[model samples]
Target: MAGVRKRYGGKRALDGFDLTVERGTVHGVLGPNGAGKTTAVRVMTTLLRHDEGLVRVAGHDVRDRGREVRRRIGLLGQHAALDEDLGGRQNLEMFGRLHHLGARRAGVRADELLERFGLMDTGRKAVKLYSGGMRRRLDLAASLITEPEVLFLDEPTTGLDPRGRAEVWGAVRSLVGGGTTVLLTTQYLEEADQLADRISVVDSGRGVAEGTPDELKARIGGDRIDVVLHDADRLADGAHALAHAAGTHAVSTDVDRRLLSAPVADRMTALTETVRALHARGIEARDIALRRPTLDEVFLQLTAARGAGRPGATERQEMPA
Candidate 1:
């Protein structure tokens, strides 16, 4: 997408949104609520047209080559769109027919999908009788009926339990392994970190940050060293020692439990010095670990800067429609 914009009356849903998804890779679209992630997916999937900008899916122009684009792509919307009255197998067969596949081929494909998605035993059961995870898997299977080259998944695992989410993740990994290009829009940070090769964070209808999970985390700052002391009275002492050793105010002390967080530019040196300092003061730490910044931390840092009216605030200027 290039300079994409969409409006619901005067309020813009997407503001000059631009995203580039390379072929055969999982590109994660991440954002907080109402960040235009859904709107962007709709435009890319050709379900909704952008007021401005060029969108190409599978090398077919979304505007000028709607049919070609649709043929090459599959979509699983935020909500499950399944025929409640129809059996799972029947629904798959119906979609396959709509895609113009032969009856025999459609039946075979439906059965294969049922097994692959762990729905084979329940294929004969009505969709309304299926569980939430079953319904989600069925929706995903429906999207793959056409064997699309490009897949658009909008918050695919929203209501799933841990096991169900894992199943979906496995299916996604299999798709990518077979060289399918995926555009995933998810509010779950761990989902993006686990699956996406690159992530683009959107906020308030604009791109705030874009990079691999590690790259974005690195941009925020250095490693975080967290120490948990045995006694609450050692909290202040731990904080002071960590601050003097780390050369930054990146320390947070919890008096109740004697927990301290210190930012370390160099983990090895910081850990060594912190251990020595704690030992010298007879402060016994129950636990200590150096943690890299999480995607959530990176997102908070980047979006916080934007909210603070920092420099490059409008670096991604909204293009005129």
Candidate 2:
């Protein structure tokens, strides 16, 4: 969608949103709460209409070709849409039949999907008996009943444990490997960093930034040095020493963790000078390490900038579950 706009009364839900996704790749959309991530996905999937600008899906205009767009795309919403009374195979077969696959064809497709998602062992078990990961995998398989060209997964890993979330990640990677283009909106930053080849960061109903994970990290600066002080009282001193060594005053500190952090231009020189400065001040550090900026920091920095600059900005409504 280019220059898309959707309004609810006086408030614009989507304001000049733009997104470009490459085929056969996972593109991640990220934003703070009420920043229009879900609204954009709704428009692209033909679930919502925009008041202005061009919106298309699978090469067909969504405004005039909603049917064509729906035919090529599938959606797995935030909530599970499975019936606990039905077994895995029965659920998949039901979905296939609903999609207009005949009885024989639906059964065959159900069997195929069950095996593909490694649910063949539990295919006969009731969905309620399945694990969270197994049930989500079954739901994912059902969404592919028609072999759609594109799939929209909105927070697919929500409410899942670490293991369960990993299971869904593996399934998504396999689908992209088999040539499915996926547009993913997730609350977990690590999930996006793991699965997305490229990412788009949105805020205030607009596209704030777009790039690969590494590229976004680069935007916030590079190679941060974190020093965990052995003494909490030495926090201020450590921050000052590191700031002088790094040649920048943008030092951030966490008093609760007794941590002092700053960005460094030259890794080796900065590390060497930091140690010397701390030792000269007789300050003891428990640990020191150099690493790249995290996605969490990038998200906070980007969104906070936009929120601070806008006049009369208030928290927008979150998308419906």
Cα lDDT tens digits, model 2, 1-321, are 899998776777788999999999999999877778888888898887789999878899999999999999989988899988999999999998899999999999999999999999999899999999998999999889999999999889989999999999999999999999999998799999999999999887899999999999999999999999999999999999999998999999999999999999999899999999999999999999999999999888988978864423323353443
What's the lDDT for residue 253 in model 1?
A: 81
Report, for every candidate in turn, its global Cα lDDT versus the true structure. Answer: 0.85, 0.90
Evaluated at residue 277, the lDDT of candidate 1 is 86
Cα RMSD for candidates in order? 4.3, 2.3
Best by TM-score: 2
TM-score of each: 0.90, 0.94
Q: Locate the minimum summed-lDDT window of 10 residues in model 2.
A: 309-318
lDDT of 1 by residue, 1-321 (tens): 888888766667777888999899999998766678887887888777789888888999999999999999999987888899999999999999989998999999999899888899999999999887788889999999989999999999998888778878988998899899999988788899999999999876778789888998889777988899888877888888878877788788877766898778889998888888888888889998999988888878777655543322221232223
Clashes of each: 0, 0
Cα lDDT of model 1 overall? 0.85
| Residue 121 local lDDT, model 1 | 94
lDDT of 1 at 99: 90
